[model samples]
Target: MTPEGKALLNIVILGFGFMFMFTAFQTCGNIEQTVIKSLNNFTASGYTSMSIIYGVFSASNLVAPSVVAVVGPQLSMFFGGLLYSAYIGMFIQPRVWSFYTASVLVGFGAAVLWTAQGNVLAINSTGTTIGRNSGIFWALLQFSLFFGNLYIYLAWHGHDHISEKDRQTVFISLTVISLIGCFLFFLIRKPDTSEPIPSETAEGLQAESTESISGSGTPRRSLCTQALDAFVKACKLSVTKEMLLLGLPIAYTGLELTFYSGVYGTCIGAMTRFGHDAKGLIGISGILIGVGEILGGGLFGILNRCSHLGRNPVVLLGLLIHYLAYYLIFLNIAPDAPQAPEEGTDLQAYITPNVGVALFCSFLLGLGDSCFNTQLLSIVGFLFKEDSAPAFAVFKFIQSIMAAVAFSYSNVLQLPWQLLLLVVTGFLGTMSFFVAEWKVEARRRDSAYDSI
Candidate 1:
């Protein structure tokens, strides 16, 4: 096969593999807080474990690029997949120690998995193809949400309460599904690194390819030194003007991601009065969220390939949709709905909470998320082509920190206040993104003029 054909194949394999892995991972994550909360009303183990996962994920991002450099993207991804499988397996027979330990390990796994994913996509794409590749991958990856939740909806739809036996059965099945994904990762053919990727600086490419050569044709820097250099390079890149400007939007993605993935589902689960099938609402929420994400991913991923509309407009549209979702959520869900459902006590909501509205809000949230992430990946791939791995590591680092902070407060903060925070952050993040886009365009024009 040609290099282009091979690149597309690798992209598909990565996306397909993640679809299987995250089907188990994300489904379990959506319900972790709720299920654990049900098991032990006295402890905040669920939210706390998630918080730890992101916290460790944030810290591990510092070295994720370094690890990718040493092991290469393929092995890095395979190793990360192994860790993800271990985390999912813990759900079958969860212990407090095992749960928290797995959380920490999975955090490290996420860092490498995402960093390696970015590296592979960047290596496989040029400026022209990054958007399409990102879109295709994202569209495929979101299918996990659909398949995973469809099972939940079917298994627990009519049942009011989930039995331990049912939970074990579901988790056992998911664990096996995740293992299949691991095997797929093992099958990804390594991309040819010899081809010159447009926009990558010679120096950056050389540095990434090796540490240094010796007079006797031996390596100069130790493997550990090379890894340290990668970490340092990532830190240096994180402080650049472009990356700094992009940080606001990147951080907002993390915050908004936590809201929909963790907090919003929790709120849905908490609403006992929504119907007799309150537990089932969580499954419905996941499925619709997946639908919304798939639509956005397909539109931006495929349609943009034809139009080349750039990233800014998609981000602006996402901002508007998010605003709409937040407003509806504020009106429909009570301020303290995420905390718990109270019986016989009147909840303070602007409108009576309708099940349809709550689920619709989830869809919007998912759609908006795809808009932000797909564009973010495209933009970063274009802007930092030479240093793709570090740039992606920095993006994940900031995003994970925001997610961790949001999760820490998810249980304590009221829904209204949380929505208010999102509104303010969204406005600022969108504006920051525009500034970054303008700067990049101006620089490109100047470079062209210089060539003339």
Candidate 2:
């Protein structure tokens, strides 16, 4: 098969694999705070588990590139998928010790899985197609949100509490779907690296080749040495000028990711006014969020194909939408609603609960997320074409740390405080991205002139 054909095929595989795996993971996550609390009578256990996952994920990224180097991207991804499957399986029984343990393991798995995914994607895509490829992959993967949440709405819509039988059935099915995704990872074939990279990608990177990470002609070395070198490279990359500038934006994405993924849904489910209808509302929110994400992914992917369009516009759009979402969340969701449910002393919000408005916020959040994430991926792929692995590792490392911090504080801070932080972070992140982008463009123009 042609290289282009293989690239497209692999992207599809990644999309479908993640769609199935996350379909289970995301749905479970959406209900985690409520379901786990109901099962064990522990109030913040779900948030704690999520915090643990991102905490470990942050640490694991330090070594993920090295692991990918030794094991290869395909094998590394397969191992990571296996870990995710294990985490979901633990839910079938739902023990505190086992649940937390699985969360830790899944954290490690997530780092390697996402890092390897970046490696494979960078290898297959050219400068021209990178945005399109990332878009396709994101759009397909977001489908999990649709299917998984739809199932929840169908099965558990009106119920306030999930039964033991229902819990077992849901988890068992999710585990099976995740396992199928794991198998799909094993089927991926890495693209041939012997062919010359296209001029569009090679223009400013003439001195550095795509094979730099392929380890094509390098002599055999100890796995320990390779890992150490990769770790050092990731550390060094983190402090580089471009990365330093881009850090805030990358970290902001992580913060917002936590909010939309788990926090907001919990708030929707916990509001006393919603009563028994909360579960159904959460499902509807999830479905709309998916729709918004899919639309943004496809739209940005097409826009990215036009060279003059750049990425800053998309970033600005995301910033504005997210601010709007936060405003709605502040006005409608009580500051204490997410953590305490009906138990909190504070129940009054600026606006009375309205299901339609809440769902609108969810959709806007998803769309804004797609805009930030797709642009971030494209920027990394374009700027760090040669050292994609270590670059991606650095991105995840910082992003996960921020995500961990966000989750940890989710239990302590009120919704108002959290919205304030997000707004500030979003502004800073977007400005940082603009500066980094300008610097990259200036450097590229200088290089072009030098060549002439």
Candidate 3:
């Protein structure tokens, strides 16, 4: 490819990457809201039903890593995209069982997309550039959430009063967009096949060497020796302590996902309690959050270009911002403040302070969160070999599990405790830096020994 052509290809791929991440998250957001709205419209008891749907969807996170490992990231992406498209269609004619089945498909597919995209970026980008690219990817996703909420708001505007035909029309439009997104997967060039492989003769020789080594011992002794050898190899390569450190920030990311997913509902509920018009407030808040994310992503990308400013500090700052955002949300939902509004007024005085707080928090959270996310990826890339997909997949699996637990816990706990969970997350986010530092020191020591 010419220089211009390669640059254009990169841009196109980046745009598609953004869209894929955006759609994955946006579709997940839409499903939850759509189910609740449909249930309310049908005058059916939906709390329990919706809870079950979310649980099944959340559980699918646990299996996504395994799927990626078995099928390869490219096929996994295709499967996820198709499954997401199908779920969108199923959502149009939702039933209790339909919602449940669809959630499972969507959740599983999302996991696949998440894993595949991370691997694709890692394979294609170098060092800090990976961080910049990841920031762009995440920014698009945040933008999607910002607008997706607006789409839901407009679709069900005066949802309490909309006709069934109007609702159906809105759902059909969303379904169409989702299907188009799935088709776009075809545009992603297959992952690079440039890495050289061992020839057949080399492989055969290696197999014979392995067999001769095994033949030197009796069967039982060989089995025992093999187990010991495998254990030692695992111990040498595996960074168990480092992995644990990484898990902390990942768990926090999971908490953030849970909070953000339910933020609209929380905002609406809080506004209603304060006698405000929640619909308008939510619409405005969503746009502000989207704008904030774009700014945040851009800022992070710029910082990544600087050698001195690195990933650790950026992540630390992001965690702090994320913590504050949730704290503000908790305050917005406090019970003692006010009453529901009188019937005729479109203006809601109760939401002014809440919206102001949320907007500021959203901007900070977006800036910090996206920065941290990019930094995390960079750290992982630095710490592991090129073929780190399995490790990445495992990390993501842990994140999904944490998110599932947090989401379920939110149903029973207050906002304050949920926000507290983020505090723990921030502390954990620092672990990657420490681990990276330790690994550097260890390598230095090993080099010193070899020199001696």
The TM-score of candidate 3 is 0.70
lDDT of 3 by residue, 1-452 (tens): 64334433543564564464454445345234424443444432222333443454445544443455445555667677776666656645667566567666666676557655555444444443444555555555555666555675665554333345754665567666665655665565533333322211110112212223223322333433443443353344345666667777776776676555544344453344333344434444555556766776677767877756456667767766776776666555543111112121223332344556755765665566676666666666555544343345445556666666765665555555666767676666666555664675577579899999
Better of 2 and 3 by lDDT: 2
At residue 144, what lDDT does model 2 achieve?
91
lDDT string, candidate 1, 1-452, tens digits: 98788888988998999999999899988877666654533353667788999999989876675676667777878889888989888877778888889999999998888867766677677666766777688778888999888887777675555567877888898889888887897777756544534535221222334322101133456656766876888889989998998999999999999999988887777776676566678888998998888888778876557765567899999999999999999988877767773231147488877999999999999999988988887788778987875687688789989999998888688988899889999999999999988887888889999999
The model with the greater lDDT, 1 or 3, is 1
lDDT of each: 0.79, 0.80, 0.52
The clash numbers for all candidates, in the given order, read 0, 0, 2
Compute the lDDT of residue 370 as modeled in candidate 1: 86
Q: What TM-score against the true fold does each predicted structure earn?
A: 0.87, 0.87, 0.70
Order of models, best TM-score first: 2, 1, 3
Against the correct fold, how does model 1 do in TM-score? 0.87
**Which residue pairs in model 3 clash with each other?**
275-341, 318-368
lDDT rank order: 2, 1, 3
